[model samples]
Target: MLILLNILSGVALLVWGTHIVRTGILRVFGAELRRVLGRSANSRLRAFGAGLCVTSLVQSSNATAVLASSFAAQGLLLLAPGLAIMLGADVGTALMARVLTFDLSWLSPILLLGGVVLFLTCKQNRAGQIGRAVIGLGLILLALHLIVEAAQPVMQGEGIKVLFGTLTGDSMLDTLVGAAFAMLSYSSLAAILLTATLAASGVISLKVAVCLVVGANLGSGFLAAIGTLGQNAAGRRLALGSLFFKLAGALLVLPFAPYIARGLSFLIANPRESVVTFHLLYNTLRCLASMPLIDAVARLCHRMLPDRADANPELRPLYLDPGALSTPTLALANAAREALRIGDIIRTMLDNVLELMRTNNAEQARATIRLDDDVDQLYTAVKIYLARISREQLDEADSRRWTDIITLTINLEHAGDIVERVVTNIQEKKILHRLQFSPAGLGELEDLHARVVANLQLGLSVFLNSDLKSAERLLAEKERFRDLERSYSYLHLDRLAGQSQRSLETSALHLDIISDLKRLNSLFCSTAYPVLDAAGALRDTRLRRRVLDATYGKDAA
Candidate 1:
């Protein structure tokens, strides 16, 4: 019972350690990884190589698959290249398995000590993230050592020997057991290493170990498929391609497992070494052989899961990934990305309103109004998703980021409402009432609308990139926009005083439009506040106190 407990504990430690390492590496180098994946892989070989490099660094093929899936889901990469990346990721994992099996028992203590110190000292910086990976590596090594030591006693037991004897080189059954272990452990690497350890200890035969390794690969594919359950069709297609590749590779290799085991036995004396070598060679050959077939597999996957004709492209939440919720930083990043999408939606709405103001097209105005529903849906989705994230799990910076995202989304929702009202007002007052502004008043309103759009674009950029210069520029534009609104208001009143037929007919509507646009500009400019505040550039007073004091002095005079 104690021995069993130790073995289970070791397995748990290995899984947890791998999780730490994956998340740590992602938090540190996620943007770079996305950039690397985002680059146009002009050739299959380049895509494959990129995948191999990224998976090796992150130490998980599943993570690579998820990244690739995200890229594909967003239409950033073609399905063929995405599948190619997954193939390379498999080879990368196999390579890591071989590298990790070496005698590194002496390094575990040093890594743990150094990693803990660095992580504790700088918990949120790059060094701390590196320390996190180091600690995970140390834990993995320690777990392996524990597994080996625990296996020895278990191997010696008559009961274990009797249990193992049931295999009798049944490749299919052994594969199933191995896959189960992989899924249960959530780490095929652990499963393969454990299988090799058992084989080395003579608890399992070499043939069974070979089959188990193949099964572990298949299990990883299964895990990827399951992981993408909540993802989009494109993401699911990429996962399906990966899963099929693994299935094909395993099916192709299983028939020769007996012969391969026999061949490996003569070339290698140690069963563990033989198992590891076979895993390496099998993945290398299988993945390399399948490189040319990526396009074909992608096509097949596309056929299996064709694009939906009825899908509403605008209504879906592009980045609200449930899987990301496990990692608070990543989840926040996803939510922020979705918030940016909302900004884009608002940008479109603003553009549509500008067109309606000029064209007086009621149909287009109604269409723009309907788009506001998309904005509202997305805002609600982002809010709910962020709410699901545990505040306790977030650090100070991430907590601030969470607040920023919530604030940005709130502002965006308000902007969308204001835009809908603007569009609705245009449809009713301008199109229905057949009212037209005076030529000068119309030109002023259009100019103000153009500046409002420019500020919104800058504000969205500032919010997304957190660029201080852009934030400053956005604030400047905000001030200019306010001046323009005041000037336009006065221009409309002058036209009203002139008794111009058009201006008098549209006087109330023109004033309302100016006020509404001012409100919209305020919401768009709000994106800059958090950025400037973070940089200590924002003053406590949002009102321009000096300008206000001058205005009050003039009024007094």
Candidate 2:
């Protein structure tokens, strides 16, 4: 009974250790990973590297897989990258298990000692990454020890031993039981690790342990599948590949079980190691065999979940999955991507505003309204997501992003308000009153439209390329738009006053659009502000001061 209690306590600690390791690494490198995932489209190799790096840092393959799936589901990551990431993730997790198997209680101290010092001592990104690596490494060892201790006496229980014998006896039966155990266990990684420890202690035969290992792999795939269930075709395909690789790999190994068990036994003892080995070999072999033929899988999944299907890609935004919330850095990184989607939609609405103004095209005007409604829907969706994230405990960087997301949602909604106004107040008024702009008035509006277009592109381009040069250009162009708007406003006013017979409706529309244009310019500026902050320009007192003075000073003036 005393042993049982300690084992339970140790299990608790394993959870805590896993949490500490995953969150710490994400706090350090989530942003960089987001960029990598965001940029790669057709490239599977790059995706695989990202998967390896993320899982290594977080020390949890499931967490990395879920994050990748969520991004792919949302159209941010391509299917190929996701597949590669899943493959690399297998190798990454095995490497971690291998590292933990060695007698490294001594090195845990050294790593953690240096990690603590580096985390506290340095103000650089490299130091942060190093500290994270150390903590992640330390956690793996500590968790391994605790989990092993927890399961040690379990092997001693006669009833449990009998159950294990029955469950792990048949290869297929063992696979099913192992998978079920893994799914219900809360942490498949823990389940496998505990099993590995039993194997190490010689409590369970290698054959039984191998079945559990295969089961754990399949169980973990459920997480990736659930995430992609409501996603786009690419996301569904990525999820399919992750599941197929694990399940197919398990099926392949059942026939050659004896040799595989012997090979793993030579290396280490523990169900966890067995689990990791299966995971590694499964992913590596599957990827090598099928990576060149991935298109077939992609094509299969595509037929299963087609592209033109405008299915509502549901994302929990918050608690979307309890499995994910503990890793705040990655969660926050996901939130930022959602915010960018909101921004991208607003850019389209702005384009519509100009399109209606320029061509008086009825279809374009209707499209603008339709798109505006979509943005509003997306805004509400994202706002709810960010709000949920805000409720979770966050580190400093994640905290800042949460705040930015709140501000961004409100700002975007305000943008919708401006678009609605343009649609209702200026646009509807123009066509209703049948008021035509004088040729001179029309040209000035076109000039303002050009500036708006340039700034919108500048904002998106800067985000995509991470180009610092575009930041300056974006700011300059926004200023140019403001100047152009003011000039147009004055010219319209002068014409109305100078011409004794000027229509009141035309004058009113001109003033309203002028106000709308200025507000758009202000939003353009704020859109770039977040990008600058993300670029670390927000920390440079010199540049920060300049941006503040230039933006606020002009506003104050």
Candidate 3:
């Protein structure tokens, strides 16, 4: 019992180490990896290489899958290239498993010591994240040593020997056991390593080890599929295609497992080395051979899991992927994209407001107002999503970016509410009351409405790119908009003094609409303030210190 417990503990440590390594590497290089995958759409070979390189760094193919699926979900990657990437990811994981099986017991203590010092001293920076990955590497090496030592004693028992004897001739049962271990461990690399260790200890035959390796590869596909259960149709299809490839590879290879093991044993006498080598060679050859079929498999996956249209597409949060939250930079980017959706919804509302004013379409006004609810729902989703990201994991720049995304989303949500109110006011005060503005007043309002819409579009651009020149222009437009509002108010007063009947009847509603438009303009322009302030272009206060000194004293100023 104690031996079994120790073995389980070692396996648990291995899984935890893989998790730490994956998260640490992702946090440090997640955005760069995203760009590499995003740019790999031009060719299958490039995409495959990108996946192989990325998974090698992160120490988990699942991390690479998440990144690829995210790109596919966002329409940045096509299905064929995505499957090619997964194939590369499989080879990468196989290579890493082979590398880990080497005798690195001497380096474990050094890595653990250095990683602990670095992580403790620089807890919130890139160095700290690197330290985290290093620590995980050390833990993985140590766990492998422990698993081998613990399994030796357990396998020597009569009951274990009897259990192992049954798996010797039954290849299918051995394969199922291997697949179960891989899924349970949540890592095919770990499962394969354990199988190799058991074979080395003489508890399992070389043939059984070979069959398990095939099953372990298939289990990784299952792991990827399970990981993508919450993803969009594109993401799920990518996983399905990868799964099909692995399943097909496993079936074709299982029947020949004994012959393959016999061939491997002739070349290498060590059972452990033979198993690991077979794994590496099998994945490399299978992926290379299967590359050409990527397009066909992708089409099949699409047919199996076609994209389903949402009943209310506007209400759905498209880019706030839950899988991205582990990597702060990726999660922030997803949130930013989702926030832009809110900005778009607000723009449509503003357009609808203008149309409502012109046509007195009460039903249209109500329809537009409901969009505000969608904005609210999206705002809540983004806020909660950002909140789930641990602040300690974010570096200084990412922390600032996190705050900026929250600010933009908040401004957009407020803008949506303001537009909804403007539509409501137009409906209740103008349409319901049967009042009409004079030609001059209506024309002035229309012009102001157009400017507001333009400013909103500009604001979204600034939010996305944070260009200094554009931010400056947006701020300048805000001042110009304020001036226009003041001048228009005075013009309405002039018409009132002239006893214009249309102006007199709709005087209050016209001024109210003008005030609302000016407020909307301010909301849209708020996206620029952070950019300007960060660049030191914005002043601390608009009030003049000289005027304060003259009115009171230097102390007051």
Candidate 4:
């Protein structure tokens, strides 16, 4: 019982160390890693290389898989490159496994001591994150030593020998046991390392270790698939494609496991070196051989998991992933993307309103008003998703971005309400009453509507990119839109004074539509205020300098 407890403690420590390392690395270099993956989509080889490099740094292929799936969900990456990246990630993890098996037991304590000191001194900066990763690496080394020390005594028992006797001749059972270990531990690298340690200690034979390695790879595929179960079709497709590759590799290797293990044992005298070398060679050869078939596997995955055409997609929040809530940066990015979706819906609503005004399609008008409900639903989802993210985890910049996302979502929801109201007024006062504006008044409304749409596009651009020039232009358009609204209102009154029949009948509706458009424009332009204020381009108020000086002394003002 004590022996079993020690082994369990060692395994738990190993798992916890890897978790610390993965999260620390992600927090320190998440955005750059994402950018690397994003830019690598142009070619399969480049994407593979990027994945290999990133997974090497992250120390977990599963993390790479999640990043690729997230990009695929956002439609930023295609399936072929995503599969290629997963293949490379497999190779990378295999290499890391080989590297970690080295006899570096002496360096673990030095790392732990230095890491703790650095982490305590600077707990919130990039250096601290580096220290955190260092601490994790030390824990990993220490856990490995502990596992080896604890396992030797337990494996010598008669019960352990009898249990291992069953796995010697059965490749399938060995593979399953290996896969179960990987899945249970949530780290294939750890599983592979434990298998290598067992083999080195003479607890497991060479053939069993090789088969277990193959099974561990397949288990990682299962992990990726299970992790992305809640994601969209695109993400699920990426996972499925990775699983296919892993499954195919496993099928090819399992039948020849005994023969391969014999050949490896003959060439490499050390059992531990043989196991790690086989893992590396298996992944490298499999990934290279499977590279050309990425397109075929991707196509098959797409066919298997085709895009789901939701009955009401607009009512759902597409980019607000719940899994990302633990990573504040990723959560913020997801929220920002969902907020942009709201902007697109608002743009569509405005376009529909214009079309209804032009053709007076009452049925279409009713359909357009329903879009607001979708906006409201999406807005509520984004709000709740952002709210779920723990603010304490966010840095200063990420906190600011969090504020921007929520603020934009709020403005968009209000804009949706205004559009609904405008559509309702047009439906009741104009369409039902069979009233039309004068030709000149109608032309003026169309012109203003076009400008509002243009500004909306610009505002969304500013919100996404935060370009100072674009933000300044968005603010400038606000003033221009206000001027046009005032001018259009005067023109509507002029037409009313001339006793134009159509203008008289729809006089109230015309001004109301104009006012609504102005309000919508204001809401859209609200995205610029934060950008300008952050850049120090915005004044405190619209009051003139002379008026401020008159109210207070120059220094006070």
- Greater lDDT among 1 and 2 belongs to 1
For model 4, which pairs clash? Answer: none
The per-model lDDT (C-alpha) reads 0.83, 0.66, 0.87, 0.87
In model 3, how large is the Cα lDDT of residue 519? Answer: 82
Give the TM-scores of the predictions, in the order they appear: 0.93, 0.78, 0.92, 0.91
Q: Write the per-residue lDDT of candidate 1 for residues 1-557, one digit (tens) a residue.
A: 67777878888888888778888888777768767877845667888988988888888888888788877776778888888888888888888888778878888899899999999998867788889999999998888888888877886677767878887668999999889888887778888778887788777889999989999998889988998877778889999999998899998989988999999999999998999999999999999889888888988999998877546777888887777676677688789889989988898998897777777787888889899999999999999999999886566778778888888898889899998988888888889976777778789888888888888888878877989999888888888888888887887778778888998887878888899999888888877766766687745463544322332233312
Instruction: In angstroms, give how far residue 22 of model 3 lies from its true place.
Output: 0.6
Off by over 4 Å in 4: 159-169, 540-557
Model 2: ten consecutive residues of lowest lDDT: 314-323
- Candidate 2 residues lying further than 4 Å off, grouped into runs, are 35-50, 109-136, 146-160, 184-188, 255-287, 311-344, 355-366, 390-405, 455-490, 497-505, 526-557
Better of 2 and 3 by lDDT: 3
Model 3 deviation from native, Cα RMSD in Å: 4.4
lDDT of 3 by residue, 317-370 (tens): 889888898899899989999988888888888888888777777789899989
lDDT of 3: 0.87
Cα error, candidate 4, residue 319 (Å): 2.3
- Per-residue lDDT for 422 in model 3? 81
- What's model 1's overall lDDT? 0.83
